[model samples]
Structures are given as structure tokens and as C-alpha cells.
Target: MKRIIISGCNGKMGKKISSCIRERNDCTVVAGIDKNPESFDGFPVFAAPAECPVQADVLIDFSHPSALASLLAYCVDKKLPAVIATTGLSNEQIEQIKECSKQVPLFFSFNMSLGVNLLAQLAKKAAAVLGDQFDIEIIEKHHNQKIDAPSGTALMLADAVSSVLKEEPQYVYDRHAVRKKRSKNEIGIHAVRGGTIVGEHEILFAGHDEMLTLSHTAMSKEIFATGSINAAIFLCGKSAGLYDMGDIV
Candidate 1:
């Protein structure tokens, strides 16, 4: 059995993961940490990482970005393996995560949907083969409550496309203020936020006389929660290093 500590226990995703883990006989949630004191399946909730009573084998974090630095510091101090599902981390924070990877296993990704990861790979391949023949664009939609525009997953897709193209694609978020012509080398990204959308992303490749599109839509949040648990299972007994979905999938 794998012992687990769930951070951000009060959030929607955290609670879902807690419930999912509790149903399993092969794994157990030993503790939950969150800013708000609340009950999760009759488990004690700690206000901070320092207050947890038992040492956990792994720490799974889906908390806010503001809390990531502190949580990572705690993980490194304890040398606890972690699976981070939180988004909105800056470039510098990402570098910090990479550094901490040397101390403990760390897994991070923009989206936990296995399909999305596959989509990223496909986009990269299409970009590489198509070369400069096609214009790529990424569009993503999520719940209005989500604070970040052009969700992290979209950027990951853009990065994949850019990396394979051998040229940087200018990311154009919005072009409403002034009239402008579409540049041949730009990869446009449009974000739509509205009414309880679980998550949706589409990647479009437009070429002369032809259009090809690849898309992934998350039907429910359970997919992400379930995927996270799967990642946790894969991380057990793994060596210390930075890892991603590709490592497990």
C-alpha cells in the first residue's frame, strides 16, 4: 500500500482525490493539508505541512500557485516525492521545481488529461512534418472561475508546436484593439471562459486548400483526479528527478 498526503484538501479537486483514494484498498490517504480547516472523509486537516502528524510517502499538491513555493520548500526539506497538478507557475518557479527534482521525485504538468498529452505529441509531429506550410492555432475553454487566461495547457501545446517547428511562434492572445493582418508565422491562442466548463482544447492547423484539427475535451474532472492518482501510483519507489506524464503514460 502507498501512503499519501493530500495538499489543498479543501479544494474541489483535492476532495475528489481524497474520496477516490479512500475507496481503494491498495492505497491510503494518511493526512490532508489545507489553508481552510475542514473535514475530508473523516480525516484530520492540517493548516500547514508542518502540522501533519505522520510522515507521508508522497505529497500530492493541487493548491494555489502562491502556496507552491512554501510547499516545495517543505517537500525538499523532507525529501518527499510530489505530484503537482497546480498551474500558473512562473518561469522562475519552474526552474526552482527542476532544481528540487534533484532532491526528490517531482511530477508536474499543465493538464492531467492523458488525451491532452497525446495531443501535444501529435501537434509536435504535425508541426515538424508540415514545416512552414501550415499555420497553427490553439483554443481552450474553461470555467469562468478559473483565473488564468489561455490556460497553461494551451501554452504547453504552443511550446510543443514551437519546439518542433525550429522557429518561435508568436503567441497572439487577442487582436480586438486594432485592425491587423494575420502573420504567417504566428500561432494564435484564444481563451473562452464560461458556465461550468470542465475543460476543452482544440489545436488547428490551416494549410493551403486544406484544414486539419486535433482536439481534446475533458468530459469531467474525475479524469484529472483519477489521472493524478495514477501518477502517484507510478511515482512510488521511483528515483528523484523531474518527471511528467510522458514518464508514466
Candidate 2:
């Protein structure tokens, strides 16, 4: 059985993952670390990883980016593998993650949904086939409570498309502010936030008289929770390295 420790145990995604684990028999949450470390779901909750006494085979983090430093320290000190699902991290923090991965197995992804990553793969293919004939635009929607604009998944999709293109395309987040014609080598990304949208991303390829759109809609948070759990299982017994959903999926 995989003994897991959940970071951000009090958050929405944490609770969701905990619930999903309860339904499975192969793994269990040995402990949890959260700022508001109230024992809500039978597992012992600590305010920080240093305070936790229980040992775990792996750690799954869905907390804020600010918590990354302490969490990385704990993981490195304990020689624990980690699956990081937190989004909107800075370049420096990402570099830190890469550095820490040298000491421990680290799995990180902007979006945990398998469908989203598959969408990225499909977008890459479309961009390669269509070449410069089609204009590309990405539209992403999430809940209002989301603090980050142009969800990380949106950028992931954009990056996938950009990677396959002959010439790297510029990412244009807003066109309304700039009263100019769209550039041929630009990828437009738009964001929509309202209600309780789980997550939605649409990639549009527009040509002279036709448009091809690839989209993925997450109806609930279970997709991410389940994906994270799967990632934890995949990371177990793996060597120290930086991993992502592509490694598993």
C-alpha cells in the first residue's frame, strides 16, 4: 500500500483527494499538512510538515505557491517523492522545484486532468498540420475564486502548439486593449471567470472559411483528484527526477 501525506489538507482539492483515497484500498493518507490544520477527515492534520510525526511513502501537494519552499525542504529532508498540483508558480519557484527534483522524485503539472494533457497533444498535432494557414486562439474558463488569469493549462496548451511550429508564436493575452490587426505569428489567449466552473479550455484554429476547435470541459474536481492520486502511485519507487503527467499518461 502507498502511504501518502497530503499538503493543504483543508483546501477544496485536498478534501476531494482525501475522499477519493478513502474509496480506494491501495493507498491511504498517513497524515496531512495545512495552515488550518483542523482534523476534519480522521487523518491527523499538522500545520506544517515538520510538525508531523507520521511517515509517508509519498507526498501530494495542492497548496498555495507560498507553501512550496517549506514543503520542498520537508520533502528533501525526508527523502520523499512529491506530486505538486499547485498552479500559478513563479519562474524562480519552478527552478527551485527542478533543483529539488535532483534529490527526490518530483511530479508537477499545471492541470492534473488527463483530458487536458491529451488536449495539449492534440493541439500540437493540429498546429503542425495546419501550419501558418490557421490563426490560433485559446479560451479558458474557471471559477471566480481562481486568483490566476489565463489558467496555467491555457499556457501549457499554448506551449505545446508553439513547440511544434516552425516559428515561435507570441502569446497575446489581450487584443481589446491593443487596437491593431492580429499578427500572423501570435497565439491569442482569453480567460473567462464566473460561477463554479470546474474548468474549461478551448483551442481555436481559424482559416479563411473554416474553423477547427479543440476543447475539454471538466465537469467536476474529481478528475484532478483522481489524476493526482494516480500520479502518486506512479511516482512511488521511482528514481530522483522531475516528472510530469506525460511520464505517466
Candidate 3:
């Protein structure tokens, strides 16, 4: 059976993953790392990564960006494979993940749902076929508690669409101050935060006379929990490297 350690075990996503793993027979959580050291139902919870004592086959993190340093350090020190599901990471934190991946197998993704990744792939295909005639835009909605704007998934979709376009594309986050109209080479991204939105993303391809839209909606946190678990399982026994949803699919 695969052994797992959950970081942020007390958080919403962490608890959800723990519950999901309970229904499975192939793996079990050996320990947990959270800000609060209080004992969880089935596993011992440590205040920090360095304080954790149990050995596990994989580490799954759904914690804050602030936890990346210690989390990656612990993974490197133990040569443990990790599945990181945390979003809203800065570019520097991303670089840190890349650096750490050189020493340990790391699976990192902005969004873990299979549907979202599929949407990205479809968007790429659409961009390629539509070419310069289509003007692209992305809009994402999350809970009010969410701190970041535009969302990581929105950026991921934008990247996917732009990667296949013939001409270079520029990202336009906000237009409140910019008095000019939308540019031909611009990919506009917008964010909305409101009451308890699980997650919603829409990719709009506007052309001269028609529009094409691809969208994904996350109904609950369970889908992400399931995806992360799959990633953890896939990372087991793998060589040290950076992996994402593309690698899993």
C-alpha cells in the first residue's frame, strides 16, 4: 500500500483529501503537518514539517504559498516525492519548486481537475485553428476568501491558448486605467470573487461574426482531492523531476 503524508491537514482541502483516502484500500495517511499540532482523528499532526517523525511514500501539500520553503526542504532532505496542489504561488515560489524538483519528484499544478486540464488542451487547439481572427479572453470566479486575482488556472489557460498562436500575445489584466480599446494581440483576463463560488472559468474566443466558448466549473473540492491523490500515486517510485497534469494525462 502507498503511504501518504498530508500537509495542511486541518484545512478544508486537506481534510477532504483525508476523507477521500479513507474510502480507498491502496493507500493510507501516515502523518500530517499543519499549523495546529492538535491530533487529527487517525493521524498525528505536527506543527511543522521538520517536527514530523513518520516516514511515508509520498507528501501531498494543499497548504499556503508560505509553506513552500519548509515543505520543499523537508522533501529534499528525505528524498520524498511530493504532490503540491496549492495555488496563487508567485513566480519566485514557482522557481523554488523547479529548483527543488531537481532533487525530488514533484507534481505541481495550478488546477488539478481533469476537466480543467482538458479545457486547456481544447483551448490550445481552438487557438491554433482560429488563428489571428479570434480575440481571446479568460474570466475566472472564486470564493471571496481567495486572495489572488485572475487566478492561476486563468493564467494557465491563457498560456495554453497563447502557446499555439502564430503571433505573440500580451496579457491585459485590467482596463480601468487604460483608455484605449482592446488590442488585437491582447488576451484579456478578468477575475470575480463573491459568496462561496466553488470555481468557474470561461475561455472566450471572439471573432468577427461568431464566438466560441469553452468552460469548466468545479462543483466541489472532492474532484481536486481525487486528482491530487492520483498525482501522489503516480509520483511514487518516479525519478526526480517536475511533473504536472500533462504528465499524468
Candidate 4:
């Protein structure tokens, strides 16, 4: 059986993943690390990975980006493979993950839903076929408590579209009076945060006389937990490398 260490064990997603893992016969949670250090269903909680008692086959992080450095450092020092589910990482933090990938297998992404992964692939195909002739736009919605804007999944979708178009798309989050018209080379990203929205994303392709939209909405956090667990399972015993949901799919 694969032993897993869950980071951010006290948070909603972490708790959901913890419960999900217990139902699975192939793997189980060995430990949980969170700033809260509170027990969830009797599992001991550590303030940090360094303090955790168990040696895990994989570490799944759903913590904040602010804590990423220390977590990655711990994993690197221990040579433990990890999956990073947290979003809002700066370019520097991303670079650190890439650097750490040389020492331990790392799988990271903003969204873990299988549908989102498939949407990225489909968007790439559409962008490649349509070229610059089509205008692309991404809009996302989440809960009001979410601190990040233009949700990371939106940026990921935008990046996939940009890669196929051969140009880095400039992101425009807000528009006011006197704003210039949209650029053909730009992909607009809009975000809405309100209510208890689990998650929602829509990608639009607009042409002169036609339009197409690809969308994905998350009904619950359990999907993400399940996907993260799947990623952790896939990363076990793997060599050092940077990977995402696409690699596993």
C-alpha cells in the first residue's frame, strides 16, 4: 500500500482528500501537516513536514504558496516525491519547483479535475486549427473567500491557447471607461468571485460570424481530492521530473 502525507490537512480540500483516501484499499494517509496542527478523524497533525513522524511514499500539498518554499525544501532534503495542488504561485516559486524537480518527482497544477485537463487539450487543438483568426477569452468564477483573481485554471487555459498561437497572450483582468478595444492577439480573462461557487470556467472562441465555447464547472472539492490522490499514486517510485495532469492522462 502507498503511504501518503497530506499537507494542509485542516483545510477543506485536505479534509476531503483524507476522507477519500480512507475509502481506498490501495493507499492511506500516513500523516498530515498543517499550520493548524489539529487532528482530523484521529490522524496526528504536524505543524510542518519536518515535524511529521511518518515517512511517506508521497506528499500531496494543498497549502498556500507562501509556505511552498519550506515544504519543497523539506521534500527535497528527504527526497520525497510530491504533488503541488496549491495555486497562486509566483514565477520565482514556479522556478523553485522546476529546480526541485531535478531532485524529486513533482506534479503540479492549478486545477486537478480530469475534465479541466481534457479542456486544456481541446483548447490547444482549437487554437492550433483556428490560428490567430479566432479571438479567445477565458472567464472563471469561484467562492468569495478565494484570494486569487483570474483563477489559475484560467491562466493555464490561456497559456495552452497562447502556446498554440505562437505568442504569449497578454492578460487583461479589468476594463473601465475609455479602454481601448480588444486586440486580436490578446486573450481576455475575467473572474467572478461570489456565493459558494465551487468552481466554474468557460473558454470562448469568437470569429466574424460564429462562436464556440468550452466550459467546465466543479460541483464539489472531492473531484480535486480524487485527482490529487491519483496524481500521487502515479508519481510513486518515479524519477525526478516536472509533471502535470496531462502527463498522467
Question: Candidate 2 overall Cα lDDT vs. reference?
Answer: 0.95
Q: After superposition, how far is residue 235 of candidate 1 from its true place, in Å?
A: 1.2
User: In candidate 3, what are the lDDT values of residues 132-171, reduced to their tens digit?
Assistant: 8988989999999999888999999999998998787999
**What TM-score would each prediction reach against the true structure?**
0.96, 0.98, 0.98, 0.97
- Cα lDDT listed for each candidate: 0.87, 0.95, 0.94, 0.90
- lDDT for each residue of candidate 4 in 163-194, tens digit (9 for 90 to 100): 87877777777766327988887888999999
Measured on C-alpha atoms, candidate 4 has an lDDT of: 0.90
Clashes of each: 0, 0, 0, 0
RMSD of each: 1.3, 0.7, 0.8, 1.2
lDDT of 2 by residue, 26-92 (tens): 9999899999989999999999888988889999999999999999999999999999999999889
Q: What is the lDDT of candidate 1?
A: 0.87
Per-residue lDDT tens digits of candidate 1, residues 34-98? 99968747778888887776687888898888888888888888888999998888888889889
- Reference-based lDDT, residue 209, model 1: 96
- lDDT for position 134 in model 4: 85
Q: Least accurate stretch of 10 residues (summed lDDT) in model 1?
A: 169-178
User: What TM-score does model 4 achieve against the real structure?
Assistant: 0.97
Indicate the TM-score of model 1.
0.96
